[model samples]
Target chain A: MKKILNDPAAVVAQSLLGLAAAHPDLLRVTTDPAVVSRADGPRPGKVAVVSGGGSGHEPLHGGFVGPGMLDAACPGAVFTSPTPDQIQAAVSRVDGGAGVLLLVKNYTGDVLNFETAAELLAADGVDVRTVLIDDDVAVRDSLYTAGRRGVGATVLVEKVVGAAAEAGADLATCERVARAAVAGARSMGIALTAPTVPHVGEPSFTLADDEMEVGIGIHGEPGRRRERLTDADGVVAALLEPVLADLPFAAGDEVLLFTNSMGGTPLLELYLAHGIAEQSLVDKGITVTRRLVGPYVTSLEMQGMSLTLLRLDDELTRLWDAPVRTAALRWGA
Target chain B: MKKILNDPAAVVAQSLLGLAAAHPDLLRVTTDPAVVSRADGPRPGKVAVVSGGGSGHEPLHGGFVGPGMLDAACPGAVFTSPTPDQIQAAVSRVDGGAGVLLLVKNYTGDVLNFETAAELLAADGVDVRTVLIDDDVAVRDSLYTAGRRGVGATVLVEKVVGAAAEAGADLATCERVARAAVAGARSMGIALTAPTVPHVGEPSFTLADDEMEVGIGIHGEPGRRRERLTDADGVVAALLEPVLADLPFAAGDEVLLFTNSMGGTPLLELYLAHGIAEQSLVDKGITVTRRLVGPYVTSLEMQGMSLTLLRLDDELTRLWDAPVRTAALRWGA
Candidate 1:
């Protein structure tokens, strides 16, 4: 696959160096490659939240390491979850006097690694809480496959729950908020093209120019459905309908709508999908109090989009409106 | 080229509808195909800041809209700047009791469109100021060839200067902060593979499996140099040497380093680059005060990376630390 680095093996290391140089105030890297955190460390008494995953998704764990997001993000190789050593180091680095929370996405490697790290840290007497995000609506039931992959809803989980963590909310409250976001959220994606994995140097799945795949995961995994290409409105409806049906959102329910691009779809198209999504929500009598349309949670260079809706309560809405400071999701004056 | 868009022409309109539906509390669609603030109207007597560009770059002008970022963002067609009419409407919608400021990237189209909007707004007795971000060090010619094309540094400008504007800093102060960031910053990028523009339907440029393009732009524009791929440490040096040399950063100079993926790069690689860059900065005696590593600004699905450095002073540091409330950027309690 085409890429910009001198060597694939060195890509992660060089990129981390570049990141540290770029936002020295907000992030710092440990010498052992196990920890990345705000240079200023955690705020006093606030529970430190640490998250990690394989590295293909930018801004997921790293760009999210800041004031209102994860205290530190440990990135592993592309599509490979970080080693237990890395997670344990991150736990040690960000474990302030209050405690530390581990936000692990539902991917098996991520969960297993974080779980192991939690045990090791527990043995070391570090207070830790682990929150597992399993919000992808696409379910894979087979002997060989892990359950449903954590797709685009991970971004919303980070944003809402990250704010709660930053508000001096304890580990329990943050975990509650995160769980609420996970339970209230559902995401469905459709891909028109298969992405080339860098290591493989070829397309993961070949699709005709006119064909599209639905329910894609972050690793270019095959979607749950494949069909002939559809118009923007139809595509948006196909994505949103499944999510709404599964979540069963009620009328007048305030929601946070996130139309996420899977790497390659332009903002114009994402916004177009956003429009259709808005109309769909209005037609369904759902009140969308907030919206985020962009490539927040993405698959690597996949040309597609996902629609994520978080059913909001008064608390979720207020938490969503709270201020945050991170390398990626920052807002509030 | 591999995009999932239905019709390239309808992408913008569709996306605007989605944004309106998604964030009714944050954005409202103007009749003229622009997204305006949902906050009644622009506050009376506040200096309105407006920004925009092509639709491919997400979380830019659109995500940066809130109390601190742009009052409104005028999104154009994918990879194309908005027309004067759209800018005029955006300016009008966001113009409050105070004046308006146009924060523009240094591309020719963007500069021209925003300049025209500024002139038109002035004709209507709206006070307007324009700050052009020309931080990309890739361009060597200042007296010719449009100088430098604005890339990832635009995010920093918007956040820091947006915070100033949100805090009631006058147009002059905001302008000064914006310019300070522009002057103190330098960026350079390299593309591994070019993105497929929606209309083009193919890669903008081609490279051998082993070759790399250095000094590239956010779009698929060719870079100043191309060479055989090297190791990550060497690549980081190649990306940063030019920036440091061009800016003449010396020992003890505190800087902000940004490792920006030109769309398709994995965050794992970005963090690797971050580590290498941090070592380089330390080795060269440069004290980095901040770092941001991710795809903040992107070029469709281009596979590449860019490095940005901002020389920080006390004022810039303070402004950088200021709280901001936008869709993408938020900080403080």
Candidate 2:
């Protein structure tokens, strides 16, 4: 695998070290269980928010840690789940008098581990709650997930709920807002090429030159089906139709449209996809109130894109627009 | 060939349209001559800074057009320079009567077209000056360039010089500061896979699975040489050694370290590269006072990374930290 890594076994640890060195003003890395926390975390009487998953989808959980977003993020090795010990350490590091909330994606391993960590933290006298995100419409069942896989909406959930926490919401209030955000979001993805895990040193799947995987999972799992490659508009339509239908957004409804690259896709193409998506939504009488287009949540060097639609209320819009300073996503800070 | 484009011939125009739609709060796109200018432009008595080149480098010229950065950017077709009419139109739109400054990368097409536009603007009673950036250490000369090709350092020059202009520097002072920044910066890159231009329908070049091109140019041009692929640390050393030796950075020198992906590489890998780069610099006794890491400047979806070091003085450091707001780069705002 033509990747920029020292050793296959050390990719996750080395990358975390590099992240800490690069963003000294924003993040601090702890060695023992490997958690990245805000440089000045543990704000007294403020609800702390933490989330994490596999390491390859960067700027997701780790890059989201800051004053206004995540209090801490515990990253696992590439395409792997973080251990319960690591999650507990992150919770302990950022717990304030208010409490701590866990944003867990719907992967089976992630759900189990975060739940175990919550139990451990509760035993240690720290109040904790969990909100699960299962927004992906790609697969109802997969090797790694149960009902549905969480995908792009994890970023949105973190941003909105994190802002609510920063606004001095109580633990119960934070959990309610997190669940609301999760319920309002849906995502679907397509892949033109498969990404290679470092240790495997080969692509997870193979496709013909003119074939593509529609509704693919983040970890390169089988999607809805394979199809002949199409142009930008066609591919965008296939992805957006399902997401829009799943959310069942109606006329006069407003949304926050996010077109995300699954890594390896250039910004130029992402913008093109965004344009098509906006037009498609308008045709269905949906008004796009806010737009974010880039590689915010990505698979490792996977040349594809995902479309996310978050049915927005006034509160969610305001929370999203709130000041946030992070390594990847930043605005109004 | 495998890109998300509607029509090969209309990629640039369509992408520009999408950009204008996505960022109406920050930018406005002018048709007929095709220039992206600040939503509120021609700030009276302030020197207007402008830059542009090929369109494949997203967020370089177009995304950089906002407060404390380029006043306007004129994009050409993919890997092609904008015509003199387009440049003249952009200068006319943002020329506030103080003067206009052009930041041209040292490609023959860009230099020639920008020079022509300068003469046209001077004839129209608008003072215009040009600062050419040639910091790439890859080639002494090439088919499209007389000197070294301008690579990642163009972003640094635009940022520093744009800040200088915003701080009320006159045209001459802005020009001088830009030249100084360009002189202090040096960059080198390596490519594992080549990016295909939309119209070309094939990669600009090809590389075997076990081979990599070192010191490669942004447009898939030949670099110093090709060799067997190595680990991330070894590749980082190969890139950093030449850049450090070329600049001959001193023991007590303080510099800004920038690790940029050539579009396709993921943030995980870029950070991994950044970690090794920082260590290598420290080993040579150079102090990294600041860091900017991302795919700010890119070559479509080329799979590689480039390292840029800008020797920093107190003034440059302060300017680098100045408040700037753009789609791609933002800090202290």
Candidate 3:
């Protein structure tokens, strides 16, 4: 494993230590629960948004923590879900009395842990709501998930709902916006190589030099099929067609198109893919009203890309355009 | 090689097409010579900052084109310097009546091409001043450089000097700040695996699974030596020692610490490296007043990182803290 880590088991904790040091202006870290929260947070009477998941998919839950995005993030170990206690700590730490909304990816572990935390909090009289993001249109069930695995659209949900929460929306309104984001967004990914969980110290799966996994999961779960590697245009189309079909995203639709690198792919190729997706949408008479292209949602050291299209209404569009001050996604603020 | 590309030769062009599509509000792409310029340009008498170099390093020259950063960028083919004509196009496009300052990386090709463009424009009575950045303290002379190779600190120079220009500083003042940034900064990198040049279809260099190259250069240039892999702290020390020694950075110096990834590494490891670097600087009695930790300057998909330290005085610190809204780097604005 040529990863820049001291001990594989301590990767998450140590990385958070680094994150805390780097963005002190934006974040505060709690080691016991491995929660990262807004440095200036828990404002009285304001709704708070929190999300958590396995590590490796960076800038997802943790890097999104700030005033305009996630108020807190509970990061578990690499490819492993955060415990319920971690989720509870994040909720308690960021709750500002209005209520707290949890954005949970639809993985089994995430749903279970977040649900447990929400129940525990509710028993204690803390108002909490959970929105499950099962936006990945890949496999219906996979190694770690019994339904569509949450992927790229998680970033979109956080951005849009975080905007709503930042605008002083109540807990019910925040949950409503979170559901709107989760419902409107869809994602699909392709993997050229598998990600190596740090402790595992080897690729989750191996592929021939000229092969790829279509409809791959964030954690290297088996995809729709193994296929011969194709050019950029073909790759984009293969992923785009399925995503468009699943959403029945058709002509005259408007979208917030996001072309994201899984991990190892550079912006040169990611943007190349983004351009092809744009052209494909243009040819279909779909208008790309907003754009996001980068390695925002990633699988650690995995070489691939995921395309996400969020059918935006006036509200989601306005929220997305709202100023955000996160470590990863920032604009308009 | 597994890469997300259509044609190796078309990667730069297609990526820019995607870039233009993704950031229409921020940029305007010109294909003839391949330059990315700010969509809102030629602000009457604002001194424009222009930088260019080989491609492959995303978010360096091209991604930095916008308000409060480079006014325009000229990108060449992968790891190859921009041609004189490309540089000329960038100069003519972004130059306002005030003047144009060229930030050239200290590579033979970059220096030659940018100098040619500056001289051609200078003869035509368009004011121009060129600042050469040679901040990499890895090796005196390497594969692509005669003096010190320009590495991670290119981002710092563009940022500080770009801020100076954005504030309407004269061309001379902007050039002075650029020079000051270059003089204060130093960088060193290590590569565990070589990056694959898309056209080459092979690793730039091969390494055994457990071995790593110390003091490696961007573009896969061989470094000081090859040795067994070490932990993150060890890896960081290997880089920080030389960077400190080269500058003879003192105990009381306040600096901006930049821990940059070489593309393939994820944020988990990169931030871990940043934390180690921060501790190392603290141990040396150095105060890190500002920090930039991410894969801002990259070499395609190389699995390694570089550490850069820019000793900041009051002016440089203020300039560094100024707003920048490029595709990659943005804050305060």
Candidate 4:
């Protein structure tokens, strides 16, 4: 692909510098390629929270480095998981005296990388806890590969858990909140068009004009199955039924409803899907206490969207309601 | 268009209900049909700031409502401008005893609708002002139409103004800050694929695999011109030159840079663009103080991106640094 970059290899490094330069008050990038943290370091007695993922999901890991969210985030190359060395640096940089927690989305590469970093931190006695988010419902029951590919619910997990951490929750408390968020959330996505990975100038997968792929992964992985084109409502139902059924959420359940664009679908259609999904939940007598509709967790400009629901309780609600000041999820300050 | 909505007319209403239910504490759907605001009225003595546009830009007006960004947002149909009545409703609902300011993007329909509403609010003896956001560098010297259509800078205007409003700036101060933000900002966008409006199932425009449309509007409106597809670096240069030349920013000037996805571009591409754009700025010796890369203000699902630059001063920097808590933009507590 014809790109404007100076050197493909230098993309991540230069971007981090620009990010730090942009929000000096909110973020600080290490001179050596180690970590991206809040402009200020680990607040006293506040258990620091850290997370890392592949680079493409900007604002997810980096934009999220601020007061209310992750204390620090490590970014890797496009859709490629961060190296353990980078994760270890972020862990060391954000480790306040109170300890630290690592929130890892359940991808094979991320799981392995974060796990290795945890071992490294443990060796350093920097007290650490790991919370894995495996929330995507797209991947069907699997005896061979793991079940769901963690997708949209990662944002809610971070926000709720970040609030807990920011409130000076102990590492255990923060980990509990993060785990609860992961357990309560479910997400599924569908794609109308396959995305083109920059390194590869062609589409990752192809779909006919009259066809759409359901249950696709964030990296253009094949979905559960393909079907003839369907309207937004049908797509919503298709996406939501599996999530709702998998979670076994019943009537009167209070949940957070999220409709995420896979980088490509417009918010117009997401709202349309959101409308149908709302009615679907209302008809089922479920109550959604909050709704977040946007491209929170995305696949690079792939024309698709995912619906995520997080069942909420008074505690979860309080955490969700608490003030946050991150670059991505911010509210109630 | 094939849609999931039970009725096209009910889309906004139902979505509002879902939004309110999901964020009862953060947002309320007023009795006036399409207006959504903070559950509570505006803070007394603070400038009541309101923004509204077509509904396709999710998280723009509504998602931005909170303590620091927008006091209220009036949502309209998919791509149609919100009626004056809707804007008026938003003004009355968010107006504290002090007054209200309307941040209208420079789209002809949006400008007309908001201006009429401002006049209506004036008739009620409600203090009001409007800042026209003509930030797009694409449209030039049009005698018949308003200059360039407002693209991404509208969000920066709201953020800076919202900070001023939150800091207890009176209406005039808020207005001054907002207008300054609009004046100092310039943006340009390019489209890789045409977005399909929800009601209009077909693509808004067509492009060959080897072509990309430059200087495009967020709503899939045509750009000043189209060009052969280029690499990410080339695309960034194509977008930045016009914005830089139009503003003629100096070498020592600090800037707040924004790389906004038109809806469909992925984060990886966005970061790559950010990496390249920052280098270009460095080569030019420009001081970039803040950087934001995300799907902040998006078109429905146009496969494109926009670059925005805001030359900053001390007062503007302070306003940008002020604490904000909203569904989208949040800062210090």
Q: Name the better of 3 and 4 by TM-score.
A: 3
| TM-scores for the candidates | 0.84, 0.99, 0.99, 0.87
Model 1: what TM-score?
Answer: 0.84
DockQ of each: 0.43, 0.75, 0.85, 0.39
lDDT of 4 by residue, A183-276 (tens): 9999888888776655666788899887788888877788789998676667888999999999889999998898887766655456657867
**Model 2 over residues A25-141: C-alpha lDDT tens digits?**
889897567799999888889999999898889878899999679999999989999999999989888898799999999999999999999999999898999999999998898
Over A202-247, each residue of candidate 3 has an lDDT whose tens digit, in order, gives 8899999999999999998888999999999989998999999997
Best by DockQ: 3
Off by over 4 Å in 2: none
TM-score of chain B of each: 0.93, 0.98, 0.99, 0.95
Q: Candidate 4 — number of clashing residue pairs?
A: 16
What is the Å distance of residue B264 in model 3 from its true position? 0.3
lDDT of 1 at A237: 78
- Better by DockQ, candidate 4 or 1: 1
lDDT string, candidate 1, B172-199, tens digits = 8878888888888888888777777676
Q: Give the poorly placed runs of model 1, Cα more than 4 Å off.
A: A10-51, A62-76, A81-104, A107-132, A142-146, A155-181, A194-203, A318-324, A331-333, B31-41, B96-100, B107-131, B140-148, B159-164, B167-181
